[model samples]
Target: MAVNIQKGLAAAGLAPLHVWNRTASKAEPVQAEGAIVEPSLESLASKCSLIFAMTFDDAALESAFSAISALSNKSKETENKILVTCSTVAPSLVQQLEHKTKSVSVLSAPVFGRPDAAAAKMLVAVLAGGSETEKNLVAKYLEYTTRKITRLGGPAHTANVLKLTGNFCILSVIEMLAQAQTLAEKNGVPREAVVDVVSALMPGPIVTGYSERIARDEFDVGFTVDGGLKDVGLMRDLASSSSVSLPFADIAHGHLERQKAENKDLDWASLAKIVRKDSHL
Candidate 1:
């Protein structure tokens, strides 16, 4: 995802892109696209006016932010630096970041897309928090990497909550596809036939894509069940706080639990396996 973001920015004529990953080897690939791999987060923070973090989860984001925050304290250069997080995190954490990082602008840009969509620059971004100027600066470079950007305005946590809810919706669709395919196969019909029928009716990416993914057993890579669980947990928390109920999320949560036990290595779309198992297929 980082490499593709850098590649898109470079293609847009954004120059001297700087990238740093906890694992230096993981960042080496971006260098091929003309980005300089920095030795430390501090070094990267020092060089760039805006720093974008695409962390895996809360802990990863915290670690990355701490490094940048520390650098901001010691150097005058990063005082006005904008910290844009593209991670899906709890809304509370986003608020905390806004509170703690007085010197830096914290903008939440939680994205929606699988790795394939990311590589294709088809990701949808939701931007929240920071001044209008700050957001425009962040969006300028981000526009190169995303299909569309939605600005939610102020209280960066709004973007994080929305990101969690978006993940819940995607997970719910995956669960629906899983159950639908299971029923089709149990009736002695092929899952591909079900996929074709759905494609003709609705013809959207999440449905068509997962239907194909489930039918072909191409669940070896991409978003993991563990990753899905983290996002689901966040969404559930959001639902609870807002006094709203998400029954599909509850259902998906149960399937994900089974997924963790049996199909942990497969891509999260393999939540379909649980439906198949329930039918004793």
Candidate 2:
């Protein structure tokens, strides 16, 4: 995200010269590239036009907010502050985050795309907030960094809902690919052959990538196995809250759990590995 912002900032001549992270050492690379490293999250929050929390889950989101809340309590005067959350979390939790940040304007602005896409300034930022003023301000701020910007409803959760929905679709595709590869490998057909056929007919990059991962067992460091499990877990929770029976989600959730139990460090795409291995591929 920092890299993405850097590229966008340079393009817009709004270069970010100051930044911070949970791991102070992680901020070194950016600092080396002409960005000032802030002493603390509080200091960082006070300095920036907008502070983005691109954390993993609801728990992480709450922890960041806890820090911000502590800081807000210390200062009597508050200026133009916006907490742009770029994390994939439940909408309800985002509302809680918004309510918790008393002085700062909270906006749900989850972004789509991986680190590489972000580095290229091609991320899709989805913005949603009750405050149109804040939302518009965030949209403009995001425009300085991302290629595409989507504005959602008049609530902070809208962007999070969109992000979760998109993740569900991605998980669905991965689950299907896993089963398909399992079926293909069980028969005389090779997984690659099946993938090639599917790629030619369907032609989605995600499916194509997962197909290769399943075939070659190449679930690496990108999007780890634990993360996949967490996402599937979130999908199940969301489906349950909506009173929807998603059998496929259940199966996917189980697959993720099994993968975690076996090889916790595997990449998320490695969910396909579980199905393939179970079928003796």
Question: Which candidate achieves the best lDDT against the true structure?
Answer: 1
lDDT of each: 0.86, 0.76
Q: What's the C-alpha lDDT at position 196 in model 2?
A: 91
lDDT per residue as tens, model 1, 115-154: 7787887889999999898888888877766899999966
How many residue pairs clash in model 1? 0
**RMSD (Cα, Å) of candidate 2?**
2.2
Clashes (N, CA, C under 3 Å) per candidate: 0, 0
- As a TM-score, model 2 comes out at 0.90
Model 1 Cα RMSD, 1 decimal: 1.7
Report the error of model 2 at residue 102, Å.
5.0
Clashes of 2: 0
lDDT of 2 at 207: 73
